[model samples]
Target: MPLSDIVRALNAPATGKRPDFLYRSGLDHPFVAAEGRVFIHYANIRLESKFLPVVDTRSGRTHGHASTIQAFGLSNSVPMSPDAVFVLPTDAEEFVYLDRLVRTLHALNYLTQPVRGNLLLRVHSRHIISVPANHGLAFEEILRPCGLLPEQITLEINTDAVADKEHFIRAVASYRSRGYGIAISHFGRTELDFPFLSQLRPDIVKLDNLLLASGRPLDRIIDNIHELGGRILIEGIDSANLRRNASSLAIDLVQAHAPILRPSGIRIRRNADGGEQLDAAA
Candidate 1:
């Protein structure tokens, strides 16, 4: 089936129910394709999906690609940060809607690439809190129609962003049972939650580089995460020395790009084992 057809079906409204936000305004579809790539038209901006490479430290191969969205003004082509883009949503419903919409955008764009391995994506904390139950259900539905498997996506949630521990744990379990990989981001940014970590047993733990700078007990934390069967991923290795030191710490994966604000024009030099090398700018 054509991608557009699948998107239409996904966006189609149920009987007697109002159309979802994506199909509202009588627009045929909120997505547009250009240069054989997909982009979403959202909130007067054009959002495009960009993947950040997650490299395996041992063999120096790309382990996976984390999906991130790059937004640009529809009229002026000015770039906008993800934070700025997300701030457009006003209420809980809108927050959930926009969160799912951006993930859908990433999923569609990922399908166009010849990349392999899991696609890691960050789920808005607000989106998780807004949904009372059935977390990951709605996004899983969208993924299925896009010809993507739940097992191929890792839903990442920042540690500091989550407010309700119980709901967050439940949501992570929901994603896990549905076959999506779970990644706990910014693990050491705030106070460590060992009990919560034990309960979740996330597939990946993305460490905040601040732990290293602050002279915290990173080795013990890494050990605990490993005991819980979580792979450690240290992001924000901007300097060569930092990258070298991070590799020596037995980190499973390392991302050299900035975690919070990723750069544009990420050129993939070579593709190996679902991992791609980033340009110097990335």
Candidate 2:
């Protein structure tokens, strides 16, 4: 669909109240990409003040008019839009957090997409129990109407959480049954049993940036993973060198934060003179 059509669809009237857990006060400027994606980030804060008197132990002098001020900030920030949204799960407060995330995205006119792409959500294994047994079913009901396929959305499970084989297997099974893609993140850092991972057969495996940065022999690992029928995604690529190296290794996907910030929309081409040309799109 055209971008204008998507914008119009997003602006249409909503039928119900917004989710209660949504941090409406801290909603940031919505960033819309040419691909029709939207992103929003927010922060939550709590402040407290207490009055107290202080005394100097060495000088034996008492002082008054002293006060203590403390501010605790807990951010539940995420990028939301029709094409894609990224969420991080830090606490076991699954229902409230997920409810707010889904409702916020739904309200932002993203749910109107006939075929939304990936909705990447980062979740820990410990909090998996907080998710309902039939959570995948609920997600299917919520996202399928928006034209999102189970494979299009991925739940990024942190490696730390996957140490428990039972929980990991169960969660993987549940999501896979509903057709959602399961990706194991922080691949190299974790001491995971490769044979066990082969058994689980995850759809995607994200290699840690540190391994790539170290200039290690990643090609062998990538080839092995591909042979096992899993696609490899290299994350935390920051420089052109890293991208070049990743491409050399035949990595399937390379994701970086910096490149998106200053998007030139430039398509590189090889000129007839055997030189590279940058063609900036309008």
Top candidate (lDDT) = 1
What are the Cα lDDT values of the candidates?
0.76, 0.48
Q: Listing every candidate in turn, what is its Cα RMSD in Å to the true structure after a full C-alpha superposition? A: 4.8, 18.0
Worst 10 residues of 1 by lDDT: 15-24
Candidate with maximal TM-score: 1
Alpha carbon lDDT of residue 18, candidate 2?
22
Q: Estimate, for each residue in 131-219, the C-alpha lDDT of model 2 and write its tens digit.
A: 64654665564443345566656666765435566666776788888887777777777454577677667767778766656667777
- Could you give me the TM-score of model 1 versus the true structure? 0.85
Off by over 4 Å in 2: 1-96, 99-119, 258-282
Total clashing pairs in model 2: 1
Our model 1 lands, by Cα RMSD against the true structure, at: 4.8
